[model samples]
Target: MSNELDTLLTALYVDLEDRVLPSLGWSRTHRRGRRPALGDAELLCLAVAQQLLGVASERHWIRYARAHLTGMFPQLPGQSGYGKRLRAAGPLIAAVITELARDVDSWHDVLRLVDSTPLPCAASRETVRRSDLAGHAGYGYCASHSRYFWGFRLYLICTA
Candidate 1:
């Protein structure tokens, strides 16, 4: 049987071996030893992949990661762990993505089309109060209503 998580991990590792591992310092010393840090690609893949599984917030990411993602990407630590790794790799990931979007000799930037509608509080209006305006129930926008209100929206953004 093939495990999706294991397969993905193997592919990711292969990528690192080819692109990243060769460029970094991977030594096992007896001193302080290496920190339990997720690689840049690992963190980014975890973040983006969890988002696909319907996780949005950092806390949610942590929880879901512990429950699902970690099972998929065991390198994913707690929420703090994932956040730290992701944050550390933000710049490097951005540069890698930017470079990947372009060819060796491309003068023009590429483009991608992305659109999403805010599914604000479509729930019972009575259920929403000034104090109830917390989280998704809080300030959200109504795309169908073409107005900015308060509530939760499916937040997902990807750069092309």
Candidate 2:
């Protein structure tokens, strides 16, 4: 891992342990099951760092982490495990981001931007008909790309 990645992981882990986990009741002792080899803080940091690094594919991200980040995340999960963990941690991740954003001193009261994009789910008609996403997915036209997509829309609100 690069020094930057190391620093980010360390700082995030510290903040999570010290500030967030206590309020959220996510301490290791409160968790059940085989007790994940990887802690919640580490998983959250990994997910956020993955997003920050623009890694869109979970499989690719797992492979990259296995090869390059093993030292930082000694117990990195496999693809499926990582997917489940990250999905479970979604709400926590969002909370963490909101908390951190509130501390951004440089951008206070500046222009805030919100944007959204489509999250493609089913492609073919048959797939769309049979998919669990049938109710949530809808036909949407992508004006920027000049194409049609069938999926749920993802709205992102953030400072830009």
Candidate 3:
């Protein structure tokens, strides 16, 4: 990993620790159960860093982080564990994004850019029918790409 990337990761962790968690009222015991090797904040930062660097596949991200980012994330879990942690942290991640956008709005930018993308989910029609997302996700067509998609759409509104 480059020094610049390291700096970004450090900054992200700090922001999450200082700003995000407290605002969300999340404590170390918030999700009481089997303790994870990495805390919610650390795992969130790792996942965000992976996306920021454009690492598409979680498996690939885990492998890369295991090889290169052990110093930053000494407790990084294996692929499956990391995937599960990230999935569980979805709400936390969303909360962080909203908080960050609000912070940016207050500190500097009032203008926000909003966009969305289809999050293709169900693997088959059966899955779509049975999945919890059945009511929320549906078949939709994308005009820009001329493609049919089945899933939920994620809209992101952020500071310009």
Pairs in steric clash, model 2 = none
Give candidate 2's whole-model lDDT: 0.84
lDDT of 2 by residue, 21-73 (tens): 78766567866678888888889888877888899999999998998888888
Worst 10 residues of 2 by lDDT: 23-32
TM-score list, all predictions: 0.45, 0.63, 0.65
Write model 3 residue lDDT over 1-160, tens digit each, in one string: 9999899889988988987888889778756678777988899889878988899999999999989999999998888888887888888788888888777645575777898887888768888888998888888877777888899778999854
RMSD (Å) per prediction? 11.7, 10.4, 11.1
Candidate 1, position 1, lDDT: 13
TM-score-better candidate, 2 vs 3 = 3
Of 1 and 2, which scores higher on lDDT?
2
lDDT of 1 by residue, 63-147 (tens): 7667655554666577676677677677666655554445345436355446666655645556565444554456655657767
